[model samples]
Target: MSKHTILGETAIQQLLLDLPDWKVIENKITAEFVFRTFADAIKFINNVATVAEEMNHHPEFCSSYNKVRFSYCTHDVGDKITDSDLKIAKQISELARNLNGKSGY
Candidate 1:
């Protein structure tokens, strides 16, 4: 497998500008999704799982009754944010939007 590049601070800042719901928390790009019900939240997570499989990049998430918090970072890239992290973050963001998951839950 090809090595992933670690994103520079400036590039990460620029990417975050476009990703309004995402924030740099620790070493990961993190976001939270709020759903009207637990089932909706789980459905959204299922959608994300498919995307992650396709992209071969998985994220860590914590789910409550009606909320899910996603943390994205490339473990292969020294656990730093990389282009893969940004790409997956965007996809997850879109999935959340389509599932009617509100941000900043």
Candidate 2:
């Protein structure tokens, strides 16, 4: 397993081009998704968990009813957004797209 490191400003900018929905906080990348219901939110979390497991990179998350807040930061680098965070952010966006028409209720 490779440890995650913070990306340079230029690299971060390029990555953010693909993830305009995500916000950068103190160099950490974050995004919050809202669903139609609690069950839907849970399902979304499950999907994220699967992706995280497959990539061996997890996120800090909070959930309540229809909202799921996901914050991705490489703790190995003192909670800074790294290439890993950008990669996962893109993956999460893909997951949302895949579930576009099949949103849980």
Candidate 3:
């Protein structure tokens, strides 16, 4: 069995509280990262993609100029947040911090 399991409603709520930069909407845990330039944003996205692939949990990415939005959910688990999503989000958050990315609008 897979180690990454679907998170319950209460666990999801706690995860949101623990990950202040992330929010859940439409059952997906989402975050938007902003970079100083378009190139920087793309580079960060590539880095995130690599990590996601490694984790075997891909995210929905939408990029426009220097802004990128990521939404992570487990389609196999009824499009809900899962442990893998939480792990990948944490990894992405750390990568964004290292790349000098900013959160919020």
Give the number of the best model, judged by lDDT: 1
Q: Backbone clashes in each candidate structure, one number apiece?
A: 0, 0, 0
Backbone clashes in model 1, listed as residue pairs: none
Model 2 pairs in collision:
none
Q: Could you tell me the C-alpha RMSD of candidate 2 in Å? A: 3.8
lDDT against the true structure, each candidate: 0.90, 0.76, 0.87
Error of 2 at 27 (Å): 2.9
TM-score of each: 0.94, 0.82, 0.92
Model 1: per-residue Cα lDDT over 1-105, one tens digit each: 746778988999998999998999897899998998999999999999999999889889999999999998888867889998998899899999997989973
- Cα deviation of 93 in candidate 2 (Å)? 1.5
Model 3 score (lDDT): 0.87
| Best prediction by TM-score | 1
Ranked candidates (lDDT, high to low): 1, 3, 2
- Find the 10 residues in a row with the least total lDDT in model 2: 96-105
CA shift at 45, candidate 2, in angstroms? 0.2
Q: Which ten residues in a row have the lowest lDDT in candidate 1?
A: 1-10
Question: Measured by C-alpha RMSD in angstroms, how accurate is candidate 3?
Answer: 1.2
